[model samples]
Target: MLDDFDRVLAQARRGSPEAFQSLHGDLVRPVAAYLRNKGVTEIEDVTSDVFLAVFTGLGGFTGGQAAFRSWVFTIAHHRIADHWRREARAPALVELTLDDDGGTTPAAEHHALDALGTARVHELLDTLTPDQREVLLLRIVADLTLEQTAEVLGKPAGAVKSLQHRGLAALRKIVEPEGVSP
Candidate 1:
């Protein structure tokens, strides 16, 4: 399946419409999900921007599939950075209170509790700087190796390891304040 993507990307670089369509179909959902996970509310808009940038920059790719994926994500990272810069002047987000309305009884409370736990994980991730988050996601979620993550972020492997270590430590502080000694 990925081999097909490589072929499509090559064709896309030559301005092939069919290849572009194939690539869009392959990537749109994952890209949107990635953006949403990164706290981009207008995921569709940003996803479109990422693809547009990918299509425009396809000619610049000098490596294979891994490199291409990294290139696409690098574009995504830049777009996310731009979004943050534009919104930097805006007010910060205030954490919301979760009150159980009578509609959600004890049974529903369990589900809500689970959701709250998951939300806490995401909230913790939100605390990291973008570079740290990017390296963390690429290493953990995307299951890329440290070397691959470094290549994607255009950073050294040692730097990627340092960021990952710091990011995980921060996540541990949020997820397990009792300490990881156990």
Candidate 2:
């Protein structure tokens, strides 16, 4: 994908429908998942909105794939913040997942939680501050590099690093208390 990214991006910039489709196809899932992890309620709608912004702004966007990814997430981050601001409330802590029926099911949700330990994961994540949580999400769930996470957060890389470190330490303490290790 990276090998053809430049060509595709250039074509997309020049108004190529195929190129735009390719870019959207490549990015949509991860972007959606990232937004979901960030607790965006309107995942599909917000994901579309993010890509719309990306495509509209692609003409002036100048960078390789890494930068492009960071740029996309930067937009997503802003959108999530905007959503929360408009609602004027904290995001819901629940991580909603759909079953094969295209709706949430108790059995399927239980299986999923057991398989991924998602309930425990969410509980642990809830212990961190919002900034620490966002840093971890961008770095781990979004599979972004330190620099990319920093770019998304508009912070110095060192600040991101510190957040990640502290966040991990907090989790570690909770998971392995009193110097006891599993």
Candidate 3:
């Protein structure tokens, strides 16, 4: 898969369904994870939207794998900003339901555990400034290189580096207040 990425990309640009599938298989999980890390509540929908943009725009795109990754994430970053803007103007709705006998169901318990799994990480992430949080998410969750992260954020590489440094320092302070880790 790695050796012939250019071929795959070329095929995808020409609208080959198999090439598209390969691209989607490779990127979907990372893209979804990045959105989830950034606290985008509609992960699946936003991920699909990002890929839709990628697929439609592939004919005009020019780059290697790293550049393609950056481009895809650039679209994702825009979608996240759009999602937040829309959310700010409208309130989200939640539906409530009761299980039989008013007790929690096993399915509910499974979901609760899943939510709890990331709750601590999210709580810690919530402490950083927005720029710091974004840099860290792009770097860690998306596994993007420094330059790629800068491209995704539309910032200079040096600026991205500074944010990443500061963000990591802040997390260190929170996790290791005594300036030590084991």
Better of 1 and 2 by lDDT: 2
- lDDT of candidate 1 over 118-143, digit per residue (tens): 69768877899877888877776555
| Residues forming the 10-long window of minimal summed lDDT in candidate 2 | 97-106
Candidate 2 Cα errors over 4 Å, as ranges: 89-116, 177-182
List per-candidate RMSD values in Å.
Answer: 5.7, 5.1, 2.8
Which one wins by TM-score: 1 or 3? 3
Name the runs in model 1 displaced over 4 angstroms.
88-118, 126-131, 169-182
The TM-score of predicted model 3 comes to: 0.87
Scanning candidate 3 in windows of ten residues, the lowest lDDT window is 97-106
TM-score of 2: 0.80
- Write down the TM-score for model 1: 0.69
lDDT of each: 0.78, 0.87, 0.89
| Model 1 pairs whose backbones collide | none
lDDT of 2 at 75: 91
Give the per-residue lDDT digits (tens) of candidate 3, residues 1-182.
Answer: 24678999999988899999999888898899989898888899999999999999999999899998889889999989987888899886987865556664568788888889789789889999999999999898888999999988889999999999999988898889656672
| Candidate 1 structure lDDT | 0.78
